[model samples]
Target: MLCQLEDDWTLFTLVFAVALLVPRSPLRFCGLVAALYVLWPAFRFRQAPPWNARQVIRPAGDTGSPMVSVIAHRGGGHDAPENTVAAIREASKNGASGVELDVGFTADGVAVLMHDDTVDRTTDGSGELSQMSFFQLAKLDAAAKHRLRDAFAGEKVPTLEEAVEECLKLGLTIYFDVKGHADQAAAVLKELYMKHPALYDTSVVCSFEPRVIYRMRQADPDVVTALTHRPWSLSRFGDGIPRFSSLWRHRWATLMDVLLDWAHHHLLWRLCGTSAILVQKDSISPDYVQYWARKRVALVAWTVNTAVEKQYYQDVLHVNYMTDSLLGDCDAHY
Candidate 1:
């Protein structure tokens, strides 16, 4: 912002000097340019940008340390049905910066807002999502498993379109978790983005699969892609290494794959800075938190649930974002 202001001021000064040197140059034009250069930011500051970049540049909201940005895990899973419209709406009410929801594809090749391949756990249905049509999937009560009508009254399954609309309606940001086979997620996201061009600025596309994250970028070069991991997924961590072969280009032949593997490994090693150190709940380590914070990598963790856990992340370890299944009332603790 300062650089931008400096450039504008420089241009205005140049224009004013040129006007004085040229005898017939319009004084009104020069004055107007100078006035605009000074007043433009004032008008912008008054109205404020959506995220209010000016406020952050000036250091608002607990500037003492790394900001505590709260991301709703599966849309505040405890407050409402996990990964459903009702839950996302409640997450907005709780003042979450971003709502993270998972995506999978249906048998009919339509994109679905689900976390698993099978609907059995989250909905009143059985079998793989690959075998179901959108019309067939739509009939099942998404919240049936939660028995949420006792609290929420009436909740139903929502399409991705519906989910996006609710976020836009509430002026809430989203951290969409693209799951399932990389190709399926990529294809669905590519098709969906066409329907919501306005969402690009406010949404982040992330996945445990780097290929999926990369594919999201290939679809929309401007989309923000974030890396994610699940410690429990055996498919994710295989024999002490990442399962995905992030080694070679599909468009390349055998010769390039070997060279690329070395490069990626070197890069990964460099990123695993200061060696690995484990910190249990009874102990604290602020330095470990500061490490990722310095890297500007939006550090996040999963299913954190206690005050001790939250403090370990925010006050001690300093994690940037967290997904929780049951923890609530953060404003009270923080």
Candidate 2:
């Protein structure tokens, strides 16, 4: 217990720092107690040995190439209808080493590929995604809202099973991005990994929520896992919760972001036994890259689109990244 506490001393330090911010002595005491109670699980955590991330995320058929490995964001959303099987195939066709796809459960509890809580954004259908059955989702055209809709018309939202099969068939690595439904998503992944043990090598489950990654490890420790983070993400307009309107609300968000960032950097990785961090592209820097390198954590940047940006990540950072389109800017001579 003492050894564990020594390793996680930073967590207690952060908690105490947050507690000290409460103006009232009685309330601060109560809040600190409550916070410690809530975070007790972290105190008991013993990190598992880190996975060999380079091997796990290596592109299929890779012949010791030195170029940065690229993953298709939402299965190359910019070129194909996002999250559809068509998009997955498009990613493979465009030479992506892997595809990052979102997974959400339907009203009937069937796992399917989707990004938003509602189908309004990606499909012609207008309704809550969680309220719709898979049968209903199947009928909606996923490509309806895309600029290239005509080219990819009649594309149906694919099930998680179908997405897995297609990715495995194409020898593409899979990054299952789960937004919520921790237990259910973990159960589904556990089943998939059981059936396809190779997933242990070629895939990872990632989420912004630590509980989701915790659940994935609980369900099956063999499955590789990563945590997604965007610094100041909690305060970002339209990205986190609704904008922090008032000054106090904004300040509170800033504080929360600091704590969250600290946890992402220190506390949660150890607790979750994460092998990598999928960070926003803008946050990647030499200092940041070197820091994680010291910890032996693989860094993967997301949504890198421009030719210049891709070249920089490849030649400078020399790290893996995800892009919205694997086609455009890909043919440029670096």
Q: Can you write out model 1's per-residue Cα lDDT over 3-35, one digit (the tens) per residue?
A: 335444554575677667766646776676768
Clashing pairs in 2: none
Candidate 1: residue 178 Cα off by (Å): 1.4
Superposed on all Cα atoms, model 1 deviates from the true structure by an RMSD in Å of: 14.9
Q: Model 1, poorest ten-residue lDDT window?
A: 269-278
lDDT of 2 by residue, 151-210 (tens): 999999999999999999998889999999999999999999999877877888999999
Candidate 2 Cα errors over 4 Å, as ranges: 1-9, 12-52, 58-67, 238-242, 329-334
Please provide TM-scores, in order, for all candidate models, with all chains considered together.
0.63, 0.86
